[model samples]
Target: MSKALEPAGPSDGVNRWGLVDLFAGCGGASAGFLATGAFDHLWAADNDRWAAATYEKNLGHEVATVDLLEVAESSADVWAAGIRARHRGPICLVGGPPCQGFSSHVKVRGDSRGRNTLYGAFVTLAIALEPEVVVIENVPDLFATRNWELFADARSRLSDAGYRVRARILNFAEFGVPQERFRAVVIASRADHPEVRFPAPTHAQGAFSSVQEWIGELSPVASGEVAEDDAMHQASRHSKATLEIIRQVPADGGNRPIGVGPECLDRTRTSHGGYTDVYGRLAWQTTAPTITARCRTPSCGRFIHPEQHRGLTAREAALLQTFPSNWHFVGPFDDRFKQIGNAVPPLAARRIAEAVLSGGSHSEAGVVEIGDEPIGSSFSVLIPGIRRRGGRLAEGN
Candidate 1:
C-alpha cells in the first residue's frame, strides 16, 4: 500500500511481475502466465483439494486447498516469501472468481445460495496483498450482471487503492482460441501507464484459420478410447435411453423436432432452452460452443464430438481450451473434467501475458522505456494489440 503502488507511466523495477491465482484449478492460468514469461506464479489457492493437488503436482508450487473465505491474508507470508526469494518485485494478481452465478449455463436464482459473494473475498485479499497488477477473467455476463455487489465493490476498492482499473469483454476467437469464448477481463494497476487494453487479434480470417482448422489434425478419439498422450482421459458414457435420443438429432442440429414437438413430429423434449446441447454432434465446419462443466454429459450441452457420436473427453476439451497436447493434468476423472472446464485457456491467457510482458520488447526498440517490471509498469507500444490474438500462438508453439 505504498505510494509507488499508485499508478505511474513505464519505468524499471515496476514491471517485473509475479503472480498469485485465486480459484486456481490445475494451474491453467499458471501455465499460461508462465508460458508468457511475463510473470511467475508466486502462490495460488483454491478450495478443491483435488484441483489444488493437481496444481501442486504439475507446477510444483505451494498451492493451498483451504476455502478462500476462511483463509486469512495475514497467514500468506510463507507464500509471499517464496515469491520475494526468487522474483524481483511488482507481483501480478491473477485469478478468475468462481463465475457460476453470472454464468449463463446455470440459473442464478436464490439470494441465500448466491455464491457470487465469494468474489468479495478476492478483492479483500487484493487489498491486503496489494499486488502491483491484478487480472480477473470471467464470463461476459459478469460485467453485465449485479450479483453480489462484488463487481461494484472491486471497482471501488481498486480505484480507492489508486489503481486504474479497466474492464472489457473480449472474445477468445479473436485472441486465437478455436472456440468462440466471450469473457469479461479486468486489468487493474495502482497507477497509470497507457490505458490497459485487450490485446489485438492475431488469428485473422481466410488466413486458413478457423476452429476446425485448429484441431483438424487430431484423429477423432472415440469414447472409451485413450488419447496417445492421455493418461487420465475418460470419454463420457451415454445411457441407452439417452443414446437413442441423440440419434434423432442431426449434427449441429437442434432438437426442435423433439423440443417444440406437436406439428413437426417428435415430442420427447420440451425445448427448455437449457438442455439444447444434448445428444448434439458438432459440425466439423463450425467452432465448438463454449465448454461447460456439464459438457461431460451429452444431454447437457453440445458436448458431442464433431464427427464422433459421444461427448468430448476431458483431454479433448483441454485441447479445445488451447492447452498443449502434451500438457498434463492430475486428479480423478470428474476432477479432471472440472479442471479443464474451468481453466483459463492457456492460449487466451498468454495473449494478455504477452501484452503485459511486451513492454520489455518495446523498450528494446527504444519506443518505451518501461521500468524493471513487465506488465504493471511498462506499456507496450510496438504490438500493444497482442492480447487480441488469443490462441494463435498454438500454431507456432
Candidate 2:
C-alpha cells in the first residue's frame, strides 16, 4: 500500500541533534525522533532493500542499504565515512539488530549464541563513529538467562568506550499504543551526560488504547475484497474452507476450535491442542496481541478481525502498532507486513526520546501493571508516587 512520498523537510542549519538509524526498519524509530522536534534524521541504513525503500518513501530521508557486519569488519567504511562527511558532529546511533536469532519463541534452526555476535557489530560501529548517544532495541529475551552473555558484553563494551549505559523493558500498551508489544531497550550516553532512564508510562490499565480506538474508523472489507480507495485496507484472501472455519469461531478474541481445521491442528501432530492464537480473532474492546511479521496471514497469530472473517489488513496492523494512518509502506503485501511488524511503535519511541533529551527518568508508579490502577486517575498525580517495600503505593498528600 504505497502512497505518494512527501518531500523531505528542509534543514534549517540550526545545529539540531542528528540521528543515524543502523537497522532502520522502514523509518519507525526515525519517525519517532522527527515527531519529537528535538532531532533531525541524518542517515539510515538497513540491509533489506524493501525496508530501506519504504523508509525513503515515508520519511524522504536517505537510507543506505548496507549490512552492519560489513560496516563493522570491512576497511571500506563507506557508510560511516558518508555520515561523518555530512553530519560532522557527534550524532546519535540507534538500532535494533534482528531479533529472530535471539527470540524465545524461535525454537529451531537457530541459537542465541550465534546471534550474540551481532551486538558486537553495533558496539564496533558505535566506537568508530563516537556518537553522543547509543540506543539498542531488541526482544526481552536478549536479557534472559540464556542470552545474558550477549547483554553483558554490550554493557562492558559501552563502559569500555566511556558511555554510561542502562537497559529497560518497555511495553507499548503502556505508552498509549493499542498493541501489546514488549521490547528491551538499552540507552547509553557519553560518561559526562546525565544518566538515561526508561520513559514513564503515560497510560495504564483501562486507560490504555483498545483495538476499536485505533482502527474503528476504517470501513470493513470482506475476505479477498480490496478497498480501491485505501490500498492498505485490502484483506488477505482466504480459501472457501478457510472462510467457513473462520465464520464458525465466535467473534471477539475467540481461538479456532481444536481439531476444526487440519492446518490449525497440524502443528500439534496428533495432539488435541497447541498454539491457541492461530486463526484467532482480535477483540474490539481490548488491545491487540503482538503484531508479528506474519500477522497478515491468519495462521501467523491471533490476527483475524473481531467481526470480520479475515486476517488484519496492513493498514489495520500499522494503526494497531501506533503508526500514522497516512504513512505509507513500500514493497508487496508481505514485505510491508515485515516492515510494519518489525518497527518500534513510534509513540513508545517518542516518549523515550523525550526522556533521553531532557535528562529525566521515565520513572512512573508502575511500568505496565495493566488493570491494576483505576482508569480515570490523573497522569500528573500518577507520576510522583513511588512503590513501597510491600508493593504498596506511597502516595503524596
The candidate that achieves the highest lDDT relative to the unseen native structure: 2
TM-score of each: 0.73, 0.81
Tell me the tens digit of each residue's lDDT in model 2 across 69-115: 65676743565677778875457788987533334323553544443
In candidate 2, where is summed lDDT lowest over 10 consecutive residues?
383-392
Candidate 1 local distance difference test against the native: 0.61
lDDT of each: 0.61, 0.73
The TM-score between candidate 1 and the true structure equals 0.73
User: Tens digits of per-residue lDDT for model 1 on 136-235?
Assistant: 8876545443432446566777789778876655556665666656566888866754334456566553331244655556666665677666574557
Flag regions of model 1 displaced more than 4 Å: 1-15, 72-86, 99-116, 192-195, 204-209, 227-229, 251-276, 359-397
